[model samples]
Each structure stands twice: as structure tokens, then as C-alpha cells.
Target: MCKFLQHTGLHQCVPSPAGAAEGTPTTHQWMLRASNSVLMLLPAYHNERVFMLAYWILDLGSKKKKKEKKKKKKKKKKKKKKKKKKKKKKKKKKKKKKKKKKKKKKNNNNNNNNNNNNNNNKKEEEEEEEEETLLKIVPTVVCSGG
Candidate 1:
């Protein structure tokens, strides 16, 4: 559930009593993924009842479908503009980072012998510690209607 919200770029969500926030509500309470996307859920909601039909049968009504279509068009325009701005900023930042990295490489080459020895020793110790952790595990229990 956390991963699904993260994928949509939504960092925070309202807590729902029924576990997942995005799916259909069990009662009068519901938690949405984002503040504004609640419109999508309300249209499909049928007097506190969950959809019993298959995926193709559920409809949000014509009014809601039209409103959602408009909202999507506006969102697409805004998203495209934001993406262009981000791409420009990323290119400039990457160029600056490459220059800084080159300067660091030159300085490191001056003390290459000592730095290489210390780095190798540190890596070996870290790998041994990681291996120990990977070998340990905890059992998990699941209950089904019991």
C-alpha cells in the first residue's frame, strides 16, 4: 500500500478503518489517496454500498465522466509544463555535478595509494557485516478466519 502511493507521487494519505485508502469504502468512512482526487471515488459510491458487478459494469454516471475528462485534460497540460521545467533544471545540475566530480578525481589521484588501501579494508569489513545480517531471519505468522 505504501509503495502504491509512492508510485503515484503522493507522500501522505488519510487513515481509513478498512486498511487500504484507495479502494471502495465499507461504511460511511473513506480515506483518499490525495486531497483532490476524492471526486473520482464519490461518483462511483452507491449509498454506502460496494460495487458488486465486474470491472466493466461500474459507472460513475455521465456527469461525473465529463467532469473527470475535463480535469484530466487540465492536469495533462499542467504536468507537461512542469516536466519541461524539471528537464531544464536537471540538465544544468548534471553539468555542474560533472565538473565537481572531475576536480575531486584529480585530488584523489594525488593520494591514490593510501586512499585505495583504506577503501579496500573498509569494504571488506562492511561486506562481512552485511553477510551476517543476510543469514538471519524472523518467522512470520498469518491467520485466516481463525
Candidate 2:
């Protein structure tokens, strides 16, 4: 009997009366029967109730989707920043290489100037030695002829 009532979506709150009394003014039994009848014949709620519930659910889903989109946007921004930094680094390295090449060229020019000065000094020394040898040979020949 209880299972049959439950199958019909009716809950038995309390125990039934002692005897099979019909149409008796039993307040607790009336309340129980009224509750059971209410459970069996469920009334549809207002449209506003369903609309409010659906609005909250949809609102929450959109908020979650927005948050995920923001995270993706942030990740994309980070990747862009990283790529920019890499390009900046490469530009700096190229500039440094150009500066080093310029410095090397300057040093080579200075070395060539120094080599030219040394060659000039060696030519002057050779000229002085030839002048000394000619002076000694001319005097010896003049003394021999006298």
C-alpha cells in the first residue's frame, strides 16, 4: 500500500489511523491526504520562475566563456611581447657587430700608418751609413795619390 502511494508521487508523512474510518474529521490525516494530493497533482510554476533560472544559467555560462577568452587573449599578448623582444635583441646584436667592424677597420689603418713611419726611418738610416762610407773611401784615395 505504501509502495503504491509512493509510485504515484504521493508521500505518506505519518502513520494511518487505527480503523477504517470513513469521512471522519481527522486533522492529521486530512493534512497528510492534502499533502499527498498536492504531490500527485503538481502545479506548474509561473513563467517568470523559469525565465529567472534560465537567465542566471546563461549569464554564468557567458561569464565563464568570457573569462576563457580573456585568458587566451592574455596568452597571445605574451607571445607577441616575446617576439618583439627577440627582434629587438637581434637588432642590438647587428648594431654591435657593425660597431666592431668599424673599430677593426680603424685599428688596421693605424697599423698601416705605423708601418709606413718605420719604413721611412729605415730609409733615413741607410742613407746616413752610405754617406759615412763614401767620406772614408774618398780621403783614403786622396792620401794614396799624394
Candidate 3:
């Protein structure tokens, strides 16, 4: 066990497999430690540096898995938000189109009403002029007979 593991109060250590030749200088020995523990085989020619490297590699693999999970969650949330925004935009566009159509209808009705009023005024003026001409002709006939 490394000093880092011993200092952290992890004293438990599992021995190497019995299959290896006992007392053979060339054989490898396995050891276990607590912090992100892994079964590490230390060759007789190698040092503690190799064991520490293996431990760090295993720890980094686990950390990468956790990061991938978090990224997936964030992507799901972003998709939901984008869908909601699109729905709101579509509704707003529909409302705007309806308002524009109503305004156009109102303007058309007002123009029709103004045209009708102008036509009625012209008819009234023509009728009054005919009445005036009839009155003038009747007075001229009466004066000539007298």
C-alpha cells in the first residue's frame, strides 16, 4: 500500500494470487488500496510508480463517465427549452396575423361607407336643381298670360 492510502486510514490489503510461484524473484505481486481501489499487479522489476499510474488511469476513466452523464442531462434540458420557445413564437405569429386581417377588414368597411355617403349627396343635389328649374318656368308662363 502507498503512503497516501495509509495516511487516509485505508489499511486493508488483499494479497496476490496463490497461482504464482512462491519466492520467485521474477514473479508479479498484486496489492489493493482504498481510494478508487483497483487490482494492481506490481512486477518484481517495476516500482510503486507503475501502481500509482494505474490507479490514476482508473480514476480518470470513472470521472469521464460521470462527465458524459452530466453532458447528456444538459443536452436534454436544452432541447426541451428550444421546443417551448418555438411554440411561443408560433403562437405570437398567429395572433399578429389575425390582428392584421381584422384591421384590413375594418378599413375596407369604412371606405365603403364613405363612398355610399358621397353618392347620396350627389343624388340630393341633382333633385334640388330640377325643382328650382320647374319653379322658374311656372312664373314665366304666368307673367306672359297676364
Candidate 4:
């Protein structure tokens, strides 16, 4: 039992099967692997030099999973933000187009008003010219006393 415990920690060692109480070294290793798989417990090393192996087993996989999930979330958020930005830009463009149309309509109205004023001024000038022509054509009659 002490030998077994030395090979596997008391907390981690599993009871040997009655059918395979005495097994070869390879068989024991296989049993340990089966036990670990059934128990869902991955082996860990408490040593310094084997730290890289332990780290590879435990740290990298979980860290990669977490990073991937975070990246997916960030990508989703970026897509949403881009969509919102596009909507806002479309709204701004529509507003700008409306403003430009309104300005054009106002300009057209002002141009019409200016044209009407010009027409009125031209009619007044024509009336003045006619009056001058009539005055020039009319002769003053004078009576002389002898």
C-alpha cells in the first residue's frame, strides 16, 4: 500500500480491480490511464523541470479556449458596432440630402421672385420710354399778336 501510494498519491490512487490485482508494469500504467480518464482527472506534476509539461497539459488548452471565446465575443461586438455606424452614416446622408434639396427649393423660389421683380422693372421702364416718345412727338401751338 505504501508503495502504491508512493507511486500514486493517496487522494488520486484508485482501488485495483479484483480480477487484475496482480498486473504487469505496462498493465498497471494502462489501468492508471483508464482510471484517470474515468475520474476526469488529468495528472499534474508538482516539480519544477516538468513544469513545462504540466503547463502544456493544463494551461495552454484552457487559455486558448478562453482566448477564442473572447475573440468571438469581440468580433460579434465589432460587427454590431459597424452595423450601428453604418446606420448612423445612412441617417446622416439622408439628412444631408434632405437639407440640400430644401436649399435647392428655396433657391428656386428666390430665383422666381427675382425674375418677377425684374419683369416689373422692365414694364416700368417701357412705360417711361413710351411717355418720352409721346412728348417728343407732341408740338406746342403758339399765337402771335401783330
Candidate closest to the true structure, highest lDDT? 2
Q: What is the TM-score of each candidate against the true structure?
A: 0.30, 0.36, 0.43, 0.37
What pairs collide in candidate 4? none
Runs in model 3 deviating more than 4 A are: 1-47, 113-146
lDDT scores in order: 0.58, 0.63, 0.63, 0.63
Where does model 2 exceed 4 Å of error? Answer: 1-51, 105-146
Cα lDDT tens digits, model 2, 24-131, are 424444333454353333343334543354455556667999999999999999999999999999999999999999999999999999999999999999999999
lDDT tens digits, residues 1-146, model 4?
A: 23433455532444554565443233344333444342332344344433343344455557888999999999999999999999999998999999999999999999999999999999999999999999899788786985
The best candidate in terms of TM-score: 3
Candidate 1 Cα misplacement greater than 4 A, ranges? 1-68, 113-146
Worst 10 residues of 2 by lDDT: 38-47
TM-score of 4: 0.37
- Once fitted onto the true fold, the runs of candidate 4 whose alpha carbons sit more than 4 angstroms away are 1-55, 109-146
